[model samples]
Target: MKQFCQTCLAGLMSVFVMFGFSISEEVQAEETGQTAYVDVSVATLWSEPNETRPVDAPSIGNPVDMWEWTTGMSYEQKLWLVGNLQTQALYGQEVTILEEQGDWVKVAVHGQPTPKNDLGYPAWMPKSQLANDASFSTLKDIKEFAQVTDPTAWLFEDKHRSDKFKEISFNTRLPVVAETKDAILVATPSDGKKWMSPDAVSIYSSQEDIEKPDGQNLVDTGLKFLGLPYLWAGTSGFGFDCSGFTHTIFKAHGITIPRDSSVQATHGTPVERDDLQKGDLLFFAYNEGEGRVHHVGMYMGNGKMIHSPNTASTVEIIDVFESDYYSSEYAGARRYID
Candidate 1:
């Protein structure tokens, strides 16, 4: 009887091993809850799922027309987007599904940390913009990854790069399947597979494999987007908000920060205004730096800082004390990189 029991136990262990069952994986899955990957090039998250207006249709569509969406909006309509839009998730970015509404799903976007949720920054996005396929979900397990390093890169349907697939934003990471001399084959969430030019992405064995860039590196990266339009809640190369610009720049260098300016103000190493260094975040608050944090910019030394100012302005570099509003509302500074 003992010998038979031992044989059965050994057989069960073999089966478990063969099926790739593990306690750690099970725990991780449970902790993660239901998850989905962003299927579009960039999915805009909203404060309210169904409250979007007709003007927002272009942005919510599968192939989002960001250029049209931003340029088509009037100044008043653009201002309306300030509090309505929460943030954006890039293609293949994993989000934990918190709840599901009629045609929308509430997801906590990973990488964009916030105090609103323990999982991540909470927001609502259309269900169609996300992929819950087993194949797509398994991409998190892949060790090799291709992280978009350029401001924007085109994913191609063919390795020759003739057929355009999608234009992915910077810092968008996808599972790398294979690589040719000049093109890399990557697995997309909804699309079967796509090819990207080697110049557009930096290959990494894992997230940890990405080298940490210095302060000057961050400033240089921000310089690439000079004059890019400012979009409320925007995080992509298409446009950027105050915090989003800082967040995306740091993310490209393998550093993740909070999604909102107010939340971001609380973290990182605090630096004095007089000792501001290159790449340090400069914050502005209401009530002349006494109230809530509202804006952020990257210090570029010599009293200059690059920032996405407001709905009316584009990303630009200016002296720290140039604007009367910013000068009066200069909150403080924070340093993420050593």
Candidate 2:
């Protein structure tokens, strides 16, 4: 018996994903800032097909990624890589380069939110590289980089000297696939750079295949990080913020969604608030007079939503239009799943 959400498109089933985690590894993410970390099934350039790995990890030795990282990842970002393996660029432009805090440092070209010029158009700016070393393995490395000073400057050169992670070869230039000044040099032997698991799992409980799961998969995969500590700008099952969670959940289902709620809201068709449905997006604006959505959440039917509220609010369920905190600031709603 398929339970259709009365509030949804007449035939759409109300997906009730109960995110839960085990005692040893319940990873839950918190929404804090504009940036976050994400762990996902990446199609790497050298991962092997049969390389024993978790569902979310890139196959060892398989050349080129299978489009793993959540789609619509803002280019001006810093992602925590778990392995010492070099980055095999597939797309996007690289701007700044350096090593900081034992992680591969980078400055990316992506869409950044900015106030309107005379045209009321949103422009892309080179945002600062935030050092969010949550990748257990990445946090252990000393190859780090940060976008400092004028991060908006697209042409920022770097020459870093870290005491940690011994230089494997200074003369040996790390091959950068992209047309960026960013160069990679092997760092000193740190702890274990052996983390290859992307920490992926099927979102469906009854499904057997790890590669794909139908509608149930989204909810099941989301529940994988039931209790992981929330981190701002997160986008992986290992730990994820609000948009990260939504992005990861949809990706597993073969659905491509923009990385942030603000962006995701634009990908799908608009729906009236009174006619909202399950899995739809609900936006909010604290400064209502400004009339711009500053926050977003997943409309989980029954007047509830699943989102990592604010820095203070944990990733939990609450009434959508009824929540005293959300209703007053409610901006609008949209849906992607047709």
The per-model lDDT (C-alpha) reads: 0.88, 0.37
> In candidate 2, what are the lDDT values of residues 1-338, reduced to their tens digit?
22223235222221222333222112211112232121112212111112223432322322212323323122221133222212221112122222111222222212211132221111111122122334432422322221111101111122232233211100111112122233222211112131110111112221122244343344444445555434345443323456756765664454656656666656678888789777777788757614666677777667877776543445677776776768888878777666
Model 1: worst 10 consecutive residues (lDDT sum): 23-32
Residues 193-284, candidate 1: write the lDDT tens digits. 89999999999888778789888999999998898889999999888999999999998888888998998899999999888899999999
Model 2 has a clash total of 49
Q: Which regions of candidate 1 fall more than 4 Å away from where they truly are?
A: 1-32
Which parts of model 2 have CA positions greater than 4 angstroms off? 1-104, 107-220
State TM-scores per candidate.
Answer: 0.89, 0.41
